[model samples]
Target: MTTEITIELDINGRSETLTLDPRVTLLDALREHLGLTGTKKGCDQGQCGACTVHVDGARVLSCLTLAAQAAGRPVTTIEGLSAPGGELHPVQAAFLEHDAFQCGYCTPGQIMSAVACIREGHAGSDEEIREYMAGNLCRCGAYPHIVAAVRQAAEMAS
Candidate 1:
């Protein structure tokens, strides 16, 4: 018999408790158990940035992290990126304004990573932004737009 563990994840500014299989990845817990499908399942192997999310305000690949590992930690999904009243986060606004996404499958993770890249002070230069955001691969070749949006967002935040 598989042992199920109860984990309380603070997601999107709210506490959501669930009794889940210990082997379930945080990505599955967020998308399957909690219905927070904004974080895509592109690779499911952590190679693609489609499953990225913010854990404790840092970018994390949910596909590689177990649900139990996220217990008691604050998790933020794309849905949480906006203000409660529906105001977009600076990165989100910039992404939209600059059309940073094509095909739209990788937008969530790209945006999440962009936010962290800027917060970590790596958005100072285009080269730095590319270096920091290298982990998030955009198959649609939207790197130019992505970099532009990230740079714009970083500037707006300063």
Candidate 2:
């Protein structure tokens, strides 16, 4: 049986309504239903931060979030970080400047979490930022550059 639930989502800057299966995860809904594939699915069990996104301006693991539960909340994915005109967000720019990503598989989630880390005042120091950003792993062992990028983005944001 298919249960259609209508959810109002503030995706990026636009408001949208979608009818979806209640069992669908926010990650799946975003990628499969809405075609927002920027949020990658790594572990899918929430262990990996590859599925990170912003919900109501806070970082969350999209793979673990229920689409129905996110109704009426603002969702921001990596694609949304850039303005419609194609200007990169400060964090995105910093990532490039620091060469924070190698394989690029985890870059989206890392950037998303980094944005939240700065916004939440957790990026105060290199050690502190590294500790806070520990959740998002970079298999390429780019932690140093990742930390630098986060610091750069934080400085730029300030």
**Tens-digit lDDT track for model 1 on 23-114?**
99999999999999999998788788988999999999999999999988899999999988999999999999999988999999999999
Which model scores highest in TM-score?
A: 1
Candidate 2's C-alpha runs over 4 A off are none
Ten-residue stretch with the least lDDT total in model 1: 42-51
lDDT of 2: 0.92
lDDT (Cα atoms) of all candidates against the true structure: 0.93, 0.92
Candidate 2 lDDT score at position 150:
96
lDDT of 2 by residue, 7-126 (tens): 887888778788888899999988998899999999999887999999999999999999988888889999999978999999999999999999999999999999999999999899
Q: Estimate each model's TM-score.
A: 0.97, 0.95
Residue 106's C-alpha lDDT in candidate 2?
96
